[model samples]
Target: MKNVETNKKIIQKKQVKIYYLSPEYVYYPIYNNNPKFFVKSKSNVFKETLLFEDNNTKNYSNISGQVMGMKNISGKNYLVLKNDFHEKYSAPKSFRRKVNKLTKKEILDILNENDAASYSSDIKYFINNFESIDSLILNLLICEDSDKIYSEVFNKYNSDILEMFDAISQIFEISNPVIMLSDTDDKNIEFVTNLSGMYPDIRIVLSHDKYPASHPLLITRKLNLSNALVLSSMDLYYLYSIVKRNKKVSEKMILISGDALNSDFIVETKLNVLISDIISLCKIKLTEDDVLCKNSAIRAEVVSIDDTIDTTVDAIIIAKKGNNNPKECINCGLCNKNCPQKINPQMYKLNNLPFPGKCINCNMCSYVCPRMIRKDI
Candidate 1:
């Protein structure tokens, strides 16, 4: 029995890849020579200390599996653990106290401190306006990369999504919390169903459609559901931190991806950190023609280096700017077909058709266009 327990500990302590990013520090696994070696941030930590004995032999099948936690202190990056080998690095006593003794006012104060007061107001508004809500839908779908980061963190922490739901329900005295998954893939559905099975009150709804299915407006329209308070997985995670962990919304998990990037990364960093700082840490070199877009590649708005990181900025895409030359549309109908909202791009462009407010701005119309016309024009 002792041997089995010891083996379990060994398996749990197995070294995994960790990528720590902060304004002052960055540590990401480099796979060319050795998968375990990580480039240090601005810290003076020795390279020898970052590598593990089994890193050479251990295959890093999934980089997300390796990320344990991310921390930032006094604008400086501290130690990055390759594995959660010890609980000494656990939550601080103050944090534990906050989690244990959470109140509505305390949670609200934390949200306000983190620039998330709008969320508190929204919850209050909902509670005040509605006597009973049909369901509280937690949207698990963001863009592909953002969804991956959300799932990984949720799984890594073994977080109970229902805990957030319970807290909200208790506060409002509302019942029926549902998780809405926009992906219909067998694997994704199975995973969501399994996680939701542990909570009897929580149910799963599979939308399983193309792009824009995750959009709140579209979800509500398609699901024929009303009086539903829709929340993103990130939002719920923040709620969990407030109610259960007594943690502030200090950092956010974001995906940095694009053709111009040396490599894609799922990074967590301090809130309101400068985009320039993150780019520097990622070692991304931007050319004159490179463009940076926040959130989804399809729907997100273009941002600049001057912008600071925010909760809504899920993914940062650094890609080469498209051709500036605009050509007349050929009326291929490709744009209309690809559009998840079924809006006629050619009509909107040529005929000056009234703008459809339903447009989710999923740049698919621009992507499918042969003439490279700007859809926003």
Candidate 2:
């Protein structure tokens, strides 16, 4: 390979890589009830079998396996099962629908019928509350540099994603529907640019590859919209899968990346896949010095490797132990300047003021910290 100078600002597009995990076991976390709901301690389960239903959310088994009763993982109870390596589904596959012609109520019906939509999801909240949206934006880059779940999905399904976006705009009667991609994503930019003539309602806007810009509050300011329904790429993908692909929701995307690992990549695996299974399938090792964090590296909850990927987790970061001791604040103004909500984090850091109500709880202050002083503000 010849040495070539490249621009540091622009991130060249890489081939879309997806790692699949053939799990020997799938752990279904129990939420509302005990695992011993049936008469037998062991039973066979098909794919998409109803595990349990609670709080208006139905849980399903992601694989066909032999149930082995309850197993506790990291203090949480999960109904474990041994996989038979057979992907037998309880229900037959659905036929694809002409989603573009669907009414708003019909679309909502589809979301409600499927397991992908939830009562507490951000997308569902916005959709149910709005009569009409001003700007419908899909946020592909959500402030995490190593989290490539969104962008990688976009890379693999750019054309279909654009079609779905257009259909959503038409169905919602949104006057302005935009998608925010990283400015350095030239491959996606060119791909969408060539197809821009087909979908006039869909506008592709490049977002800054910097912190705080992808925040909902700052995104509205950047797009100059009164009110917007901003969704993550995964959020829209769930809807897309329900409408465009007409497939029952089974697999979920997760990004496993950190300095402790050899490289960064995304994994497309079944829902509720165990973190330990992901690590083992990917051949990842956790040394004594390395720590595992859920969703974020510095400003996230520390998790054990046995944790299962529930609805809340999007990324698992395995980080090497470094100097995490908080240093004295040097009166730097980065926290104040980078705050998307305009509430000064410096006052709270110094114990001069309590945590303000206006704080959006973004990690901008810690992300911009030079001395790693403010890890959570």
Candidate 3:
């Protein structure tokens, strides 16, 4: 075979390439007549107490409401009780004393906080009026917690996620469909497997691992499917209805993790959210003195959290120093030795190579560094 100069002709002749261009994002405004659909809301912390003598309440007991609380202050907000529910708390310290308590209402509030119309109303308009199915498009729905599904919106419609999965199964019925599970939790595996098995030619392949092993895209790759639709584990039913009814998605799912003042919780935020806002969501503390990192050490660097509260900020690593000089390669060969994909990173740095073709951007070199030198792309 002659040396292939251009990928275009060769790729076309050999049919070794696949082209599936991402479509232009078109927002389909979902409208529902009856509002009050459930959505995960931004957690709010309110300090309250029954201001009375003998504040010696052994524990803030007998308070009853449908509340979902977390033990770890690292990734979520904790509610603090200063006064009884009867007494109205004051401002300033009252707000600071109690941690944010996340609820569906709070999530909806954040979604429509900027817009004049309420998010509930927005949802209702879409659910009730929209009739076109062609408007549905793909959305990258994400969930942070491994076990739980992130059900924020789309809970009120008849076409829920489970039904959507059934539809997708029907579409892929020609292929031997298998359900792959990412978590070791047997209950989750059982539920998903049983649900997937309802369709005619689909079978279950359960895998309990830490990573997203059950991701349909990854599974499809193994199954060698021509096309695949990836859906989030959270509210598969809701997403299904949204896709089936409106046939479109305006937003994409993003996960916020790492060090911050607040605990980590999934929020349905806009795409343009800034880095600063994301830090506030993490619930992890970051003083001027603190540093943050994310993904891997090589990819980690300093980030500023101000003005912007968005998911993009959470993935950043807050560094202590700025890049003094794009440090010259030390020829330690460590980058080569540590590469999981067997690519020579040190050579790329030394030669100032135009492109390191095999570089997967794993950031392994940055992780093994003693001086914390930022990795070159």
Candidate lDDT (C-alpha), each = 0.55, 0.69, 0.34
Instruction: Report the lDDT tens digits of candidate 3 across residue range 1-377.
Output: 01111111101011111111111111111122232312212222232212111222111111211123212233322222211233222333211111123233332333233221211232433233323211221222222221222322222221244455444444323233344443444554455555554554445454433222334444555546543433343334333423333212223343343322233344444322334444554444556555554421134444434222222222343334433345555666665676655776666655656536655565555544433333564
Cα-lDDT of candidate 3: 0.34
What local lDDT score does residue 56 receive in model 3, on the 0 to 100 scale?
24
For candidate 1, give the lDDT: 0.55
Per-residue alpha-carbon lDDT of candidate 1 for residues 36-97, written as tens digits (9 for 90 to 100): 43433332332113232233422111111133333544443222333222312122534544
Segments in model 1 whose C-alpha atoms lie over 4 Å from true places: 1-115, 118-133, 182-191, 245-247, 260-262
Task: Supply candidate 3's per-residue lDDT for 334.
Answer: 60
Which is the winner by TM-score between candidate 2 and candidate 3? 2
Alpha-carbon deviation at 55 in model 2, angstroms: 5.1
- Of models 1 and 2, which has the larger lDDT? 2
- On TM-score, the leading prediction is 2
**Tens digits of per-residue lDDT for model 2 on 197-232?**
998778889877565566777787788997688877
Candidate 2: the clashing residue pairs are none
The predicted structure with the larger lDDT, 1 or 3, is 1
